[model samples]
Target: MKVLFSSWLGEVVDNRGKPPESWSDCPAVTLPDTFGKDRPMSAFIGWGGVVVLNESYDIVETAYKYAQALQASSCAKCFPCRVGTKVMEDTLYKILEGNGSDSDLVQLETLCGSISSNSKCGIGQLGPGPIKDTLDHFKADYQAYISGGKKRPNYHYPYKMTAPCTSACPTGMDIPLYIEQIKEENFAGSMATIREASPMASSLGRACFHPCENNCRRDNVEKSLAICKLKRFAWDYENTHEVDMPLNPNKHTREERIAIIGSGIAGCVTAYNLALMGYRPVIFEKLTRPGGVQLTGIPQYRIPLESLDAEIKFLEGIGVEFVCNVTFGKDETFQTLRQKGYKAIVLATGADLSKGMRTEGEDQGYEGYYGGIGILKKIKYENAEIPKYKTVLTVGAGNTAMDCCRTFARLGSNSYIVYRRTEKELPCDPHEYAESLDEGVKYMFLEAPKRIVAENGKVVGLESVKMELGEPDDSGRRRPVPIEGSDHVIEADCIISAIGQDPDIFYMGDEPKIKLNKWDNPVIDEDTMQVIGVPDVFAAGDCAMGPETLVIASGHGRRAAQSIDQYIRGEEIHLSDEQIMENIIRKIGAYNKNEKVPNPKGWERQPIPICDRDKKLSSFEEVELGYTQEQAMEEAARCMRCYIVGMACVISDSEGGE
Candidate 1:
């Protein structure tokens, strides 16, 4: 974390002339000492300012590259940002070319001020701050370059454009761009931008736990924009207008066939992307219907079957083939798939097998004992009749538990959620928790299921233990400890265990080639999503990353597809420069919750419409009513477009000098 010089956000720490012992660290800023793996970074220039780590780096050329980066990233929304950044780049290029002078320094300073004052967005306003700092603190280096006394250093400057919400998103979605498209009344354009990262817009628009809104800059003003709702608006617009979904022009152009072993979010996303890249992808589902757990584990009230079906139809239109009732280890082994001409295999089987409660009488086949996911499958896929039980107690606090309890409540049962922690520590989304309460689903906090109380092979009640929160555990949540002599029985006819899920890779058989972690999930290279030591086999989704949100699973799917493409083409499986820059910025921290936004308040966030409480509880129907066109536009306008440019000066061995 040591720095030779820094002017980040005006918290200056100049240790250029001091010894290592006497040098002080900058309190205002912190950066990773190394870039990717062990590659040391000499300097980092961004919207804030510059930080010099290695003194040997040519400060003049670094500044010039930073300026060039800014110019290249400019959106040109305004006169000052567009023309001003170009002028700044030209002036720096002149100085780097060994063409004179002292007057140009003053001109550069003036231009920086103008761009900062008049630019429309962060790229224009904050991009000039680093250049201004360099001119002030590293003026001697610039003068040397102009005086023909210094040589340009050979280094590679890789830069990328990113926004806070975009960087925080699991898919690295261009959030601001889509919102801007909505503001411009370009619904199709917004969908196009979203399709760049994911093709499950309709499904995700409904079921995704949107992490982007949590880091939105607009939260500083009043509240975060309705980002998830805005996405739904775009997809709904396309659907309602009967607009023909565009098919990938290069679909099925490639000869190699790829086999994806699940129809869930991860598998579908991978197939969609591969099809777009002209590769023929075939998705295999063991169940009679596709859509994987998204159709079975998740309740119909959250994501309707019709909606998911429409998304599947779109994927089919793009040249993805689906085969139902086909099992992996049973019907087709990894070796057989390769023998059958499948160039690659993706395992996205998902973690649908419910983990045990580790209590007594739970595993025994009792009349009313049900695993959370098992009950949901019977209700959704099998259309099981309503249970006659009056009381239903579900254990766990995740979204799955909420769905189970809420679904039971809708079925006229007295549903209860039992968790070891307090309501404040609930792991489910805030909205899901709130809605569960509103639906008459009760909660028993500070209670953990001890044993399943059954009579004559029929579940009757659940023996629970009072719990107290102790020190934080590895998951960063307070560990729950049972209080002595605090056991009690919660009388109920039905007991459901919704604690957690593990990947059902039983399909992998006993002697699988792919490695698995301690949790039994497939172990793959985190960056490439390729199975460790098995180049032709890739894994993603709940099967690879335990249990995660749909967005994160989709991201894994996208990255795996990219790696598969490179592998088939006989190219190196590596991240692009833009993806590398994304990792760098993410490590540096994108959304600053403490940072103050200059915009004024009073633009309240538009509220999304929902189905009536009584009507929604009467049947399994989609809850959210989505946003109207007027509401969507108003919400989109609240986006600050908080885009920032980040550049890294890597020590390259190439001879080119700029």
Candidate 2:
């Protein structure tokens, strides 16, 4: 094979035995350009004379070229590069004179390190790069000159690393490792692998939005793999069939007792991970039953109570204490918690306050005009007189609004969602909106609510005006403009407002102990989930991040747990949001391998099944059925093992290192 290796100095070698002088005479061409990108060839031409390092080449001649290159390139300014390069040249000439010693090889490595690290210019600094590469990959060539009898080993091509989906997971679940374990029919092993980073595997499997699937490499050919469902399949298998939740491999006693306030996904996740780390984690819940938004905020049909219960039970089984019916400020304050022997406190009380339409007649106190979240919470925790409303008008096009409309429909009430924007601009999940439509829930888009008309202190009708699209707003969606003289009145017994909600800091009290943002939320170092300036206190979930998805909240919980653990252990205290992102990015990784690993081609994403429309509307049951074992194995096999490739090529130097 023809080998052409050249540095900036090797601009002289242009495939000719002699060096090319003028630019016009021999145009500069890359090594691959001289041979071919697909061909088997290697070249190393540095600042001067070329030394082709292919096994078929004459090493004596190449050594002479390397010596001449080193000799011609010594600038007298920098001590390391100027003196080191000349010494290297003298050593090479000694080797060429058949008088080199073992000490010469040691000196070469020392000089390479000093020149690479201490050089002033790019020419001097990167000059040892070729030697570094040679020492690492072609060290035998140097050894052959020194010792004797050097037979070239058989050719072997390096594996190319590639995995996008693994890097996409927020929890960094070692997606490819679990997938590979599944491919081998090792369901138990797969679950163990998943439990390394994420404890809410079952919950995530059932409800995660799966950012990983969106970035799946398979999407280039067919659709993305059913990654979420696959995880659910493994979790379902492990939970229902195998021995319950994952256990702590090494259990030890701990003096540090951490307190996490809130029983939402974030709070629960933090407690679970901390418990695994051998710390006593106690979660305090204000509500009667824990599972903050998971129990009350989210509808039963979307997330079953039993699933949440079983997951929480797992946490309890692993020595995590759940103290329900305890309000943070009323029962235990920040100072009180510390006094009670809790080393650190994690505030993950999620944003539960539902926003109002803020239109006319909103403050007049009309009867039966409740917040969408409040209505859902009531319906979820206990059955209220929902059917008595007869006609429900929900203002907002979010998932909460959809849930409200669906709940009313199940209770045999006429429900309609009045959205300011069109269906195309729906903020809710598309599937939720579509299912609501299927359940006979009505929609009135491009009709902005102006006010709630009342009769005898009761909501009787909703007054709305037709709206038109205008310029884009801060949200990047076209602004809705109300049309003149297009006012209309829709008769309704109830009006439900579900615009949005923020962190309600009322529980913190007017005294204001911890620092708060302009929005009244706690100011936190987003990377560490630590409350800024409050060492022993940390925050997570909706309260910290102003209402994120369940998966995101859980991720925040994990980070908050990390921060709390670090703080208690007297580790690095502060981290900026960018550092938090770097930590996640490093764990998830960018590219598993430089080369794209080949996956099974032309396979369509397995379709997820849902309950029959009649059955779905009649009762609160899980809608999307999880993947079967056979289906899961097939999907798991299609993973292409990108993360395994990444693990195989784990950089010894640093992350992103070659």
Candidate 3:
């Protein structure tokens, strides 16, 4: 087997005046005697080393063969490697075929960097060696391919800022990291990393609003990978199947007791993490069961009761004691818990109270005007009897509205969403909204409910006015203004207001121990989440954050736990700006300093399961079924590890540190 390596460059492997026809023609190029059994000699391609085989098997075809082999042989551990390899090979082919641009060379190098740095194991780590070697030793090949018999572009832009996707994640989750993991079939490892930052890996995987996807480099390719939903796959597996989480032992224990109120995702996570730090932490829940809204608000269809219960059980197993049906302010006061020998108190009572439209006839005999929280509570309780309504109208465009509409559909109610803005302006996730629409929920966009009309002391209809988007509002969303002479009426048997919710602070007396905001949420130091006046009193979760997602609330719990640990240890409770800057620099280091490459292609995103539209609307047995094990493994294969094995350091020989 002989091969002729082609490039405008002078270097070519020649067998005594006859150019080699294949890599096998060159004996000087060493091939490993044996590799993984699944992988054989035919699977190998090109010279494997840069320093050793500097120019052997340097042909682009041989490199392509090696690249393809890697694309196939890779455990698919990380995104950049699994996907990036295919992309890099494609880009290389274009360059070889004379369709290459100056940017193509830059993209090839960028993919090379990603593959080298983000891949897990030897195959990925060494996969890019040939391309890099060719680029370094046979630079003329890349130059000739891109230059089209001309010169390369000058003054490439440098110093691009950190991407927004990575910036928005709380735990600094490698958004791109696990995407590659999904590509690699390393579902277990990917899920383990997710659990490091969040205990509710399954919940977050399904429901997290992935800001990472928004900033995805792939969105520049096609659409961003459904990053959050992919996370759901890993978590769904961990929940359904047994997964191991090795507990990190911390021997240092402080003789302090911390009281965390609510026992929801936030409270439970806080208490669980606190226990891991050797603190005797107890969670107080006002409800009969723990999990707060996770128990009483999120419907069984979205967050299955078994999954929620399993997570709560795991927290309990980890030494987080839950005191259910014990109202913090009602049964025990802040002073009482403190006097009971507790050193700190964490308030995670979520925003469970629904916000009313405050319209007239609301308190009257009108059957309309269902409170958002109240409706969710009813469905979660699993009572057979539901309020029989012919036509139901919901007010709001947030996730609550979507939840309300879905629940209404399951309850045999013909549901319609009356929002103050267009579909683009709806606050709900696009996927959730799409699911709601699929389940037969009608949407009346650019309309707001004006009043609930009733006949003979019974709710009959809803009156709404058409709305037009005006200038950008303070919320950074386009403001919705009523359109003149566009008043509309929607008939309704029951009206559900899913606008929003408010925190109930009446239980906390008018004391200076904890400061309260005008909105009735506890005012706390932004960093510590500790009530300003009450150093020992930490606040987290929905009520603390003024109503956010379960994931953000969990992040709050994690942060508060760390802060509380610092407080108990009498250490400075602040993250230095230098530390923050260094972290930002690390992510920047992950990205290519040069041109951006096209995202890896040839794999479709794992599809979330959905019941038949009619079936979905008629019952509450979870609309979108979770990912199967095979699906999860396929998805996990896509995550780019992004973990650099060895830390980069500057050696100083003068200090004898070299």
Number of the top TM-score candidate: 1
Global lDDT of each model? 0.88, 0.70, 0.66
lDDT of 2 by residue, 414-515 (tens): 889999898789998876888898888999989988888999999999999999999999999999999999999999999999888777676666235578
Q: In model 1, which runs have C-alpha deviations exceeding 4 angstroms?
A: 20-23, 26-30, 655-658
Instruction: Tell me the tens digit of each residue's lDDT in model 1 across 449-501.
Output: 98999999999899999999999999898999999999999999998899999
* Candidates by TM-score, descending order: 1, 2, 3
lDDT of 3 by residue, 1-658 (tens): 2333321112344333343333434332323321211111121222233211223222444445446556665556578778988897787767666687878767777878778777664446656765665565556656666666542221111111123344456655655556566666677777666666677776676556665665554444444566777777776766666667445364226567789888777888788778888888888888778777867777777777777787787776666788877876678878888789988888888898888877666767565567888878876854546778889888897888888888888888888888888887789988779888887899888887777898987788887888889999998989999888886668888988888999877767835666678878888876678888777888898878688887778778888998998888899776433223324244323232232433467566667777676667677776677777677666545443322210111111232110
* Winner of 2 and 3 under TM-score: 2
Error of 2 at 149 (Å): 25
The lDDT ranking, best first, is 1, 2, 3
- What is the lDDT for 441 in model 3? 92
Query: Where does model 3 exceed 4 Å of error?
Result: 1-166, 174-188, 242-254, 382-384, 484-488, 576-579, 582-595, 640-658
